[model samples]
Target: MISQTLTLELKQVLGALLFGSRRPISVADMRRVLLEVAEQNGDVGGRFAQTSA
Candidate 1:
């Protein structure tokens, strides 16, 4: 499991990456991207939840 601190960092990073994105990003897009990254390191949900907040 990833620490909350690290999760927050990734959330910030991913948010920044997505902020410059063009067009609308749907829920599936967010889920897929977060799951792909999270399942790899076991922290996707943490980052994803942060984004939702």
Candidate 2:
């Protein structure tokens, strides 16, 4: 389960990505970037598994 603080941080990061994008953001693109960020942070313990369409 994602902690509230982490969830907020993720939201902020994704929001920034969306805000800065020049084109529509696809789920695949967001998932890929989120996975990469999770991996870099060593926190990818299925936190994103429920994000599937």
Candidate 3:
């Protein structure tokens, strides 16, 4: 299961992504961003790996 703090963090990141986007974001787009973030910083704390969309 995802921790509460991680859930909040994910929401914040996703919100920021959507706010900055020029068009509607897709699930595949979101997953790509999430995976990229996970690969780059290792700070998403494996949340994507732990849970499903």
Candidate 4:
């Protein structure tokens, strides 16, 4: 399981990415961004499961 703090951090990142955007964000796009962040943080394996849903 991922930590609540990490989840909140990801939410913040997502919010930043979506803020002031003209186009609507898709699930795939969010997943991709999250996966990138997870990979960068060395939590890709653990985070992947959550993203699948």
Predicted model with the maximum lDDT? 3
Q: 1 or 2, which is superior by TM-score?
A: 2
The CA lDDT at 26 in model 1 is: 73
Candidate 1 — what's its lDDT? Answer: 0.59
Q: Please report, as a residue range, the 10-residue window in candidate 1 with the lowest summed lDDT.
A: 44-53
lDDT of 1 by residue, 1-53 (tens): 87565443565646855896787777667766665665565654545543442
Model 2 residue 42 CA deviation (Å) reads 1.3
lDDT of each: 0.59, 0.69, 0.72, 0.67
Give me the displacement of residue 2 in model 2, in angstroms: 28
TM-score of 2: 0.61
Q: Estimate each model's TM-score.
A: 0.45, 0.61, 0.67, 0.55
How do the residues 1-53 of candidate 4 rate in per-residue lDDT, one tens digit apiece?
87565343655767877995589988788788777776667753346436663
In TM-score terms, candidate 1 sits at 0.45
Task: Tell me how far candidate 3 lies from the true structure as C-alpha RMSD in angstroms.
Answer: 6.8
The TM-score that candidate 3 achieves is: 0.67
Ranking by TM-score: 3, 2, 4, 1
Which residue ranges in model 4 land beyond 4 Å of their true spot?
Answer: 1-8, 20-22, 43-49
Q: Per-residue CA lDDT of candidate 3, range 1-53, in tens? A: 87564333677778888999999999889888877666665655466544458
Which candidate order results from sorting by lDDT in descending order?
3, 2, 4, 1
Top of the candidates by TM-score: 3
